[model samples]
Target: MTSSQVFLSIALPFAIIPLVLFTSSKKIMGEFKIKTWVKWLAWIATVILVALNIYLILQTVGILK
Candidate 1:
């Protein structure tokens, strides 16, 4: 259960890091590139998700309480 918890919280969300990068890259998306504001929002959301995942991992490992 602990491994499952860690995998779910950490491994799964790691994909978003690349997703945002690829989507925001003008060279990658060209005309479909994400707008600047939306790119900023995505980065902000990615940061928040990473922070929350770190918190989750810490709590699961009994380091946060």
Candidate 2:
């Protein structure tokens, strides 16, 4: 991917984090709180996504050389 693509990939997840946090609230879930396992999975997924984005950035910048 190009620099713009790498940037967008990183930006999209950064943007989604706020949306996810917003949806996890009592306002969205009402009486249904987010489960521990689900939260853990989300955290893990976020970490992996971030790592991928960082790797993509490094690759695009030729830092992986």
Best by TM-score: 1
Model 2 spans > 4 angstroms off: none
Off by over 4 Å in 1: none
Top candidate when judged by lDDT against the true structure? 1
Q: lDDT values of the candidates?
A: 0.88, 0.76
User: Clashes in candidate 2: how many?
Assistant: 0
Model 2, 1-65: lDDT tens per residue? 66689769769787767755765677777778577677778778877887888887888888995
If scored against the real structure, what TM-score would every candidate get?
0.88, 0.71
Q: For model 1, what is the C-alpha lDDT against the true structure? A: 0.88
By TM-score, how accurate is candidate 1?
0.88
Q: What is the lDDT of residue 40 in candidate 1?
A: 98
Steric clash pairs (candidate 1): none
